[model samples]
Target: MGEVTINNIQKDESGILKENKKINALEDSVENVEVDGEKYDLTIDGYINMQESEEYTLFLRKSTSGDNYVLTNALLSKYPVEEEEQDELFLEDGESLEETEDLKDTYQELYQEVLKE
Candidate 1:
């Protein structure tokens, strides 16, 4: 006869997870590095509030689907940063609804008058 035994083990519950409103904001910190006779400071964003034991590496490359660059790193510099535009989308309140309707009617009447002219 064979002996039977059961053992239970618990998993580690410590790790970084993605949060909806708790995204890590990247800080762009460019510094010049002397390589041979030339000096260059890479434009990149530094990670904020990251653990020290985490192992990772930053990557600099062009996006596969678009013409842009991205930087990925943790602390001091890390993550992809893209060039984008900030445009507000809204309607202008130059005229009220009734005034706008009147303007439209006036435009039609003006077109008729011009035709007569």
Candidate 2:
């Protein structure tokens, strides 16, 4: 697996309130994202292993401990980026990527939010 530098996003006051709104209905929408760092530990699920030199599109979230990052889910989160093998969804089954629209949307949107920092 290649190393990808992560950039952390600190929440603004509005962002924090947005999170609270989810639990208390304080905001109409959620726009905040979890922070990341250049280097941190990775917590992976045992269903598959990441290999060196392979390109992947991974969706990661900060763990509750606020230290290491969590791979969103085992199969659905780690996407192999090889153009030829793009047809393959996952090694085994749970749900296809297309089926996880909300997750993809969450990560995609969060990623964009992070980039704004």
Candidate 3:
């Protein structure tokens, strides 16, 4: 087992929680931060979309038996900006995900099958 570094923890003037942490390799696995545009993202279920320039107040809990931290209340712990306040971050002139009907789906289907087992 290995450990990652948690450096700084503070809040911005807008009350958004900010953290400076370095992801280190766990066991033999390599780790790094994922950045899209100007935003940082942590892969959750490998399906949740990461919005650029989005801010959230994340409530996290460190694992009692491992070197990991997870959202305290699934997604309820991470509250995004109000819809009105998020309008600018999503200016129509900037980047966007094109509408598509076909795409890869992960976990959800398999989870349903497993549940029926």
Candidate 4:
């Protein structure tokens, strides 16, 4: 294969599609990437375990630098999260009671919208 250009390509189970005029087309393109002089493959499959526990673990795979580390709950609580990235820090799974309550509110709002039909 030739060097993959930074083009807006889409692919599904079939293969890569250069032209996707329709909406909701799959954009799955796995490739090897080099970050901080270390080589790592950007895998689309199983990137995030949706069925797994709510405890998110962010890791830098195959890092040559010593700074590559995993971000656990203990480490997360130690540092004060910046105000700007609040939305990103919010839990998508909502494992705790407080988070669950917020998720419930969002669910109800979405339900109401669906029922309007």
Q: For each candidate, what is the lDDT?
A: 0.31, 0.40, 0.36, 0.30
| lDDT score at residue 57, model 1, on the 0-100 scale | 26
Per-residue alpha-carbon lDDT of candidate 3 for residues 1-117, written as tens digits (9 for 90 to 100): 233343345333533333565332222112255566454434322223224455443445555656554555432343343332323322233333432111112222333343353
Clash totals in order? 5, 4, 0, 0
Model 4 spans > 4 angstroms off: 1-21, 25-94
- Candidate number of the best TM-score: 2
Using lDDT as the measure, which candidate wins?
Answer: 2
Q: In candidate 2, what are the lDDT values of residues 1-117, reduced to their tens digit?
A: 223432322343334222212121011112223447344233321133555566555565545654344555643555445532322332334454564555555545544543453
TM-scores of the models, in the order given:
0.18, 0.34, 0.30, 0.20
- Per-residue lDDT of candidate 4, residues 1-117 (tens digit): 111121333223334334422222111233446899986645332121212222211211212334222222211211111222334333343245664566445644543443352
Off by over 4 Å in 1: 1-96
- Model 2 misplaced stretches (Cα beyond 4 Å): 1-46, 84-117
lDDT of 4: 0.30
Q: Sort every candidate by TM-score, greatest first.
A: 2, 3, 4, 1
* Colliding pairs, model 1: 46-77, 71-79, 72-79, 73-78, 73-79
* Alpha-carbon RMSD of each model: 24.5, 14.4, 13.7, 16.9
Residue 85 lDDT in model 2? 30
**Which candidate, 3 or 4, has the higher lDDT?**
3
- Of candidates 3 and 1, the better by TM-score: 3
